[model samples]
Target: MGMRLYAIVIYLFLYLPIGIIVLFSFNAGRHASDFHGFSVKWYGKVLSNPFAMDALTTSVTVAFITALLASVFGTMAALGLQQFKGRFRALFDAAIYIAIMIPGIVIGIATLIALVTAFGYLNPALAAAWPEWLGDAPRLKMGRVSLIAAHTMFTMALVIVIVRARLAGMDRTLIEASADLYATPMGTFWQVTLPQIFPAVLAGFLLSFTFSFDDFIIAFFVAGSETTLPIYVFSSIRRGVTPEINAIGTMVLAVSLSLLIVAQVMLRRRDRPAA
Candidate 1:
């Protein structure tokens, strides 16, 4: 009975706030504070906010870029280090840990500085050759690109960790068997090794995507003028919580949660054996 009550207490503590927010999302009033008769007047407000929509678009673009870059780099790094053991291998592991375990503020500041410094260090030829879309210096200091880069930097270590674990779980016999079949290194990797890891790579992509989407701290520091959903919500709170905010929050919560669930379900199906 005590344990049951304890479990119940924990559940309420964790989910009660979510329940309140969700219940109040359809609120007729702007803030959840005073109960107005239930209606979705606020949900319509979320759609009508032009600034909010721009912020949302910018955030989504940045996060998409971040997820793509992180997945490619993380998966490649994991694959390269998978069959290795030695001093450098251990060093790489420690680096991954440091990347994640460091304070977010510190990382954000470092990233912001690095962006400026890197722009300075680029050769004139390199800078000239750079695509027109790639902004220079402090322009890099803020905006969609900055937010994406910040999120990617913060979430990269986690991606490496997940992909590495999945690789470690992979069957070594298949790799050996491919080699024994006289398949060339590149061919074996493409044909035999990659298929086994596709699910893991996909999982990492979704994980990184979700993290990049929801991040607030690094976004607060490195995000120039554009606001992500979390940042938007935070800023809105200063003006006092309105039902419009809750409506946006409810939509964000719905979309994010749905993606997560669908990703998990797909992963599970991928893992299961065919009859």
Candidate 2:
């Protein structure tokens, strides 16, 4: 009974706000002042908004790129960390944890300065060298590119932690067996190592993608002028809550929740005893 109460309290705290958002999202009469009748008209308005669409497009592009980079790098880092067993293991692990724990705001500001500064350098260099596309295009914000890079920093840490955890529980004999079979080092990794880790990689990618997609704080920091869906929703709140924003919010929430659920389902399938 005590644990049940604790669970109920936690669930309520976590999901009550979402319940409210989902409720108000369907509220009719087109007023944030109070609840009205239920209608889907707000959803229709959201679909028609070009600005919201653009923000979503930008977010998707950034999320995909961030997820891909982080998954790849994190997997490599995980494998390398596993190979290392010494007093220095803690040091490397600590570094990864530090990156994970650092505030998003700090990461964002640092990324913005680095991006702008790099562009400042590249802009002049390209002008002197190619005197072509880079010169005419004039890369400043690089919009989605900057956002992706910044997001990857956090996502990479997430991937590393997840992949390392998966690796820790894995059977070590397969790797040794492949080595004993005289398979080349590269072959062992590609054939033996990578297959075991692929699910984790996919999980990391999806997890990173959803997290980055829903993220507003870090994105806001490094996003420059390229607005994301979260940023768009935030910007719209000041003007008053439109049903359109509610519709968009509902979609975002649904997508994130769905991806998370799917990832968990896949993990559970792998955990089942073989027939």
Candidate 3:
């Protein structure tokens, strides 16, 4: 009874603020401190706000691209690492964890500085190499491309970790059987390995999408002119929180929750025995 009560208390402590935010998102009044009765006016406002809509679109596009690129690169890296042994494998594994363990702020600052310096050096050469017809297309700088690269750098580690965990648990006998049947490396990967590890890849993609969508620190440093949803939300709060901001937060929370649920379902399905 005591343990149950403690667990309940812990859960409430963890989730009460989120509950309050969601509850007050529908508040009719502009003030978040007091509930001024329920209304969806704030949601309407969020949808109608052009800046907010633009930010949302930017965030979704970045997250989608980041997830896709990270999933492909990470899955490939995991497969390559799985074939290695001993010290090399251990060293690579440690590197992946280091990326995951590093603070986001540190990563953001380092990435920003690195991108600015690299672009400063490379942009001149890139311009020189460009065709006359292109007419000096804008060179890469700190913007959407930098943001996507930064997001993929960190999120790819997460994907690798998830897919590697799945791979570690996979049956080696299946691969051996495929080899015995004279399957090519590509054939074995596509026909035998991919289907088995696909659930982890999907889960990693969803997780990467969520991380990129909600990320603020790295995006803030690297985004330059482009405003992502999290950056917009932060700016709104800095200006002063409104009911519309609350409504946006609620919608974001809903999307994140839905993705989590879908990922969980996929994992469970993967774990289920074949009937």
Candidate 4:
């Protein structure tokens, strides 16, 4: 009884704020705290707001691209690492885990410094090397490219972990049979290995998209002039909180929960016995 009570208390402590946000999202009042009556006008306002829409578009685009890149590169890395020997494999395993464990602030700062340094050197060199005919050489800077790159690098570790977990449980005999049957490696992967591991890859992609979409720390540093949904919300909150903010939070929460549920379902389905 004591443990149950404690658990309930802990859960409430964690979720009460989220519950409040969801509840107040429908508040008719202009203030976030004062709930005059239930209305969804705030949600409509949020959806119609041009700045918010632009930020949402940016977030969705970046998240989609980030997920795609992370899935592709991470899957490739996971497949390649299977062939690696002891120490090298262990080293890479540590690196992947460390990338995931590292704090977002550290990643954001490091990415910012790295991009700034690289751009400083590359922009000048590129301009110097450019032909006089082409008006001005394009310069590298912290923006969408950097944002996508940072997000991909961070989320790729998650993909590697998920895909590798799937790979570890895969039936090796199927692969052996494919090889014995004189199937090319590429052909075998396309027909056999890929089908088995695809679920995990997809789950990883969804998780990557969710993370990239919700992220503010890394995006804050590398976003340059671009604004993501999280960044926009953060900026908005600096002025004052309103029901619209609550509505935005509720919408983000809904999206994040939906994706998470889908990812969980995919993973569970992957674990089921063959029909």
Cα lDDT listed for each candidate: 0.78, 0.83, 0.90, 0.93
**Best lDDT among the predictions, by candidate number:** 4
TM-score of each: 0.85, 0.87, 0.93, 0.94
| Tens-digit per-residue lDDT, 1-275, candidate 1 | 99999999999999898888888987776557777888977777788898778778866777789888888888888888867799999998898888889988888888778876775566565767778787862323456776776777656777788777767767788889989999999999899777877776777777788888788888887886677877888999998877777777777788778878866865674466422
lDDT of 3 at 86: 98
Q: What's model 4's overall lDDT?
A: 0.93
lDDT of 4 by residue, 178-201 (tens): 999999999999999999999899
* Cα distance off (Å), candidate 2, residue 214: 1.0
- Pull out the clashing pairs in model 2: none
Tell how far residue 79 is off in model 4, in angstroms.
0.9
Which consecutive 10 residues in model 1 have the weakest lDDT in total?
136-145
Off by over 4 Å in 4: 1-9
The C-alpha local distance difference test score for the whole of candidate 3 amounts to 0.90
Q: The CA-based lDDT of model 2 is what?
A: 0.83
Model 1: CA > 4 A from native: 117-141, 265-275
In candidate 3, residue 55 scores what lDDT? 99
